[model samples]
Target: MTTDENLGKAAIFDLDGTLLDSMGVWDQIDAAFLAKRGITVPDDYMETVTAMQFREIARYTIDRFDLDDTEDGLMAEWDRMAHDAYTSIVQPKAHALDYLRYLKATGARLAVATTMPAGLRAPALGHAGMLDLFDAIVGVDDVGRGKEHPDIYLEAAARVGVPAHAATVFEDLLAGVQSAAGAGMHVWGVYDESSAQSWPAIQSIAQGVLDDFAQAPRPLA
Candidate 1:
């Protein structure tokens, strides 16, 4: 499919695992955080928190590890650990910036539907040279829930001046794909090692599947 087939549509992207190759930041944080308590990061930890909001992740962490930390305390610690990486180390996924530009040039409205806050997400996308291209950026905080709900995707499309059905969401997690598709939008699953285990499940439900942004729609012109 090409942009010619979906002109003027909004392209909503999930930041951490979809448009940006930044899931490693969380993995590093998880290992370091758990190691401080003399525990090793479990294999299922990342998968469990991949679709959760920061508060949810923190709460889950405290309960799972029997840690004596409140959600706020854990979240603050994570923010401190992640600030430097998001500001400097995180980068756009392969061909992602080019694909965003391609969509823009073809008159597709762009938006980010992410769990990352403005401070972190903005700099990361700016560093990747595509921050200014997005017409809107919405987060789970903006919707009061995680990607398990379609609220964020709906808000992003509305902010970009498109109806849900006219928007296409690019996501790396099955939860995100399911939520956006359930909202009556087109959902394309983007490849990310963090969600590799769900790739088959994602492929089954998503309207499309992409190895990278290169496989996404483009302008024939």
Candidate 2:
């Protein structure tokens, strides 16, 4: 699509698995967090909490495994464990930065709808050189819900000053795709190794699907 075609359209992106190759960090954290309490991560645990808000994940974990940690305590522990990694080690997905820049330069409004913690959002995206690329960034906390619902995506569109129909959401997980599409936005599935199990379903639902940003659909019909 030409720059003219992109005018007035908004692009909403998810951070962790979609634009950033950071799901491994969370997986490692989950394993470590469980190990600290003398257990291993259950096979279904990751899928269950993948799209939940940080606080929701904490509460669910505490209840599922009977962990003796309060929601605040667990969240604090996760923040401590994740802060340095995000600022120092996390990286973006292949060609994600270039694609975002191209879209922005072509006049597409860009926003982020992510499950990333509020405190870590800026530092993490900044570390990946993505902090300046977005017109708006809204996290689960901002919408008071996770990707399992359409609230976060809707908030991002609202902040971008675009109607849902004028926006397209790029997501790696099935839940994110489902939620964003439910909000009446166009949806494109971005493939991530972390979400490989759900790729087929995502492909069925997303209007377009690509494993790399370089292959992301242009014009975004």
Candidate 3:
């Protein structure tokens, strides 16, 4: 676990699996999308797209399956399938709100750096009553690269007025944890059943791993 000395003045978060219990919604979207075409969702498809942006996922889906659909078309369909669920059905992960509140009370700045697009992210965060809590929300579109690069995390820390090394990033995916750590930030990996396959890798690299936010170590005195 990271000690108080290692904690930063700003905390950067990944939305989907880290803060919001919404990865299941994406799984359903993938299943429903492929089902419409009479194609069963491949077991490895979700894992392959776990850290990709919408457009990247769209391109990968089309190429991997040899589908004739345009990238934009696939992206629009996924957005349509996910919009309502994100805005209405998705909830914050266990103890997430409490953790955010604790950070806020400690005078730490908060920002969301997520692969989810603005159209879906804004509504989900607003519905979860967390939209106003963040000092900034950086989406994949905001950066030139995805989580495989450190651009998004760097931008998030900059937006919140923190240096990369002085920012702690909360993420659930190995790609994200790697990105933030690559950017010289301390990473805390949150657990999600959907990402169980990568837990060992995540644990090995992250400064800390949290099975639930309730068990998150206090990062401030």
Candidate 4:
């Protein structure tokens, strides 16, 4: 755990798996997409795209399946599918709302930096009853790059009117954590047992690993 002072800290969160229990939606989408085409994806399909950008996942699926649709069409289809699924099944992660409220009550600036399109992120946040919680909501379009690049977190900090070094990023995917860490923010890696086993360099990059946000330690005075 990081003993470094947490003064002037802002908290930026990755939306999907970190704040919402929605990682399984991706696997369901992949399975349904492949089954519609009469091809079966490998069991590790979700692992292959664990932290992938939406466009990257669409491209990979297109190439792997020899999909006849244009990249634009494929992305549209997937986006629509995800939106539908979110409306129907997605739920906030355990203690997610409570954590956000706690941050607000403690005067920690809150923001969401996600690879998901704003169209999706906006409604999902509202659906989860968290739309008013964030000071800023940043999507891939705001950064022009995905989480693989550190620009996303950097831009997120900028939007939140904070410097990267003073931010704490809550991330579920290793790639997202790496991006935040690369941008000089302290990360809190939220573990999902179904998706990931271990992150070796977490001790170096993250403030701590949390099974849920409620486990985050109180800020040091």
Residue-by-residue lDDT tens digits, candidate 4, 3-49? 33444678888887889888888778878878898989787777676
Clashing pairs in 3: none
Model 2 clashing residue pairs (backbone): none
RMSD (Cα, Å) of model 1? 2.7
Distance from true location, Cα of 204 in model 4, Å = 5.8
Task: State the C-alpha lDDT per candidate.
Answer: 0.86, 0.90, 0.87, 0.77
lDDT computed for candidate 2:
0.90
Candidate 1: Cα lDDT at 215: 81
Q: How does residue 49 of candidate 1 score in lDDT?
A: 82
Q: Write the per-residue lDDT of candidate 3 for residues 1-221, one digit (tens) a residue.
A: 22344234888899988999999999999989988888899899988888887798898999988899999889888889899998889999989898887777667889999999778888889998888889999988899678888899999989988888878889998999988898789899999988999999999999988978897767732
Against the true structure, what is each candidate's TM-score?
A: 0.93, 0.96, 0.93, 0.89
Per residue, candidate 1 scores C-alpha lDDT tens digits across 68-113 of 9899888888888888898788888889998888887777889999
Q: Kindly list the per-residue Cα lDDT of model 2 for residues 87-202, writing each as its tens digit.
A: 99999999999898888878899999998888899999999999998999998888788899999999998998889999999999899999888889999999888888999999
Span of ten consecutive residues with least summed lDDT in model 3: 1-10
C-alpha lDDT of residue 212 in model 3: 83
Residue 75's lDDT within candidate 2 is 94
